[model samples]
Target: MRFLVQRVSDSSVEINGEVVGQIGKGFMVLIGVCDSDTKEIADKMVRKMLGLRIFEDEQGKTNLSLDTVGGQLLLISQFTLYANCKKGNRPSFIEAGEPGMAEEMYEYIIARCKEQVEVVERGQFGADMKVSLTNDGPFTIILDSEQL
Candidate 1:
């Protein structure tokens, strides 16, 4: 499992020209599931996302968790996160989980996030979607479960 976490002032996802999900003052999480990913990986990622202290506190220190800041979450399924380009110009997604498992993990993450945040919005799992966000502090973090 992997995640691209960006602190955002606002974020939204649209599919087929219709707004699907949106959030404000939160983190936009681009999630990728690998073939080995299981419910354990999904659970771990959700816990880390909710607990990561990247938001600013009263002293202007980046010490507040999402819950402390009352922030939302925008989760987007992005298998491209697992792209492997070592062999050629084109990237290979062979490391990513198949559609069925990927979709299951994606939905599981969303359900878990909804329980901990003020709001948890999600992009269409396998749809052509457009995502927009205003990055807060220009802070971006890339996380991989295997690294942890």
Candidate 2:
């Protein structure tokens, strides 16, 4: 599993020109799942992501967690995060989880997120999505399960 976390002022996902999910003042996370990913790994990743204190506080210090700031969430499934480009110009998705299992994991992550976040929005799994966001601070973090 891998989480590409981007702190955003606002974010939205569209499919066929219809907006599906959106959030404000929160993290727009692109979640990637691999064959070895488990619920435990997902749990740990979510914990690390939620615990991140990248948001600035009153003192202009980056000292606030998502909970402290009452932030929402916009989660999207992105298998491309696991794309392997070591061999050629084209990327290979062989490291990404199979569709069925990946979708299940994706849904599980969203449900787990909803348990902590008051507003957890998500894009449709396997859909052709157009995502838009205003990256706050242009701040981003990549959380890989292997590193965690």
Candidate 3:
């Protein structure tokens, strides 16, 4: 499992020209599930996304977690995060999990995240969606389950 987390002031996702999900003042999560990913890894990543202290404190220090600031969550499924491009011009997605399994893990992560935040909005899984966001502090981090 892997995730690209970006702190955003506001974000929205549209599928086929219809708004699907949106959020304000939280992290925009682009999640990718690998063939080896399991529920354990998804759970661990959820905890980290909720607990990671990327928000600023009263003193202007980046020391507060999203929970402290009362933020929302915007989660999106993005298998391209695992793209393998070393071999050729066209990126290969052989490392990405099958659609069904990936969808299960994606839903699991979203359900888990709701426990820590006021709201958790998500894009349609496997859809060609349009995502927009005003990145806050331009703060971004990448988390991989294998690294843990």
Candidate 4:
């Protein structure tokens, strides 16, 4: 599992110009899963996303967790995150997990996140979605289960 987390002041996802998911003052997390990803890995990623201290504190330090500031989450499934471009121009998605199983694990992450996160919003599992966000601090974090 991979989590591309962006701190956003506000964010929204649209399909056909119609808003589907959105959030205010929180993170816009794009998730990617591989065939080897298990529920345990998903659970670990959820723990990190919720507990990792990326938000700013009163002392102007990046030391606050999402829950500390009452932030929300806009989770989106992005298989393309695993696209491999080493071969040619066209990216290969051979590393991305199968749709059926990946969607189940993605939903599992969402459910786990909602357990501690007060406001959890999400994008459609497999959709051509357009996402927009005002990045807070332009701060981004890429978390991979293999590294953590």
Q: Return the TM-score for each candidate structure.
A: 0.97, 0.99, 0.97, 0.97
> By the lDDT metric, which is better: model 2 or model 4?
2
lDDT of 2 at 124: 97
Give one digit per residue, the lDDT tens place, for model 2 in 1-148.
9999999999999999999999999999999999999999999999999999999999999999999999999999999999999997999999999999999999999999999999999999999999999999999999999998
lDDT of 2 at 103: 97
The Cα error of candidate 3 at residue 47, in Å, is: 0.9
**Top lDDT: which candidate number?**
2
lDDT of 2: 0.97
Candidate 1 structure quality by residue, lDDT tens digits, 43-111: 887888788999988899999988888899999999999999999799999999999989999998888
* Deviation of model 2 at 98, angstroms: 0.5
**Model 2 weakest 10-residue run by lDDT:** 37-46
Candidate 4 achieves a global lDDT of 0.94
Whose TM-score is higher: candidate 2's or candidate 4's?
2
lDDT digits (tens) for residues 1-148 of candidate 4? 8999999999999988899888999999999999999999998898888887988888999999999999999999999989999988999999999999999998999899888888899999999999999999999999999999
Each prediction's whole-model lDDT (CA): 0.92, 0.97, 0.91, 0.94
Query: How many angstroms is residue 104 displaced in model 3 relative to the true structure, after the best TM-score fit?
Result: 0.6
* Model 1 poorest ten-residue lDDT run: 109-118
Report the alpha-carbon TM-score of model 2 versus the true structure: 0.99
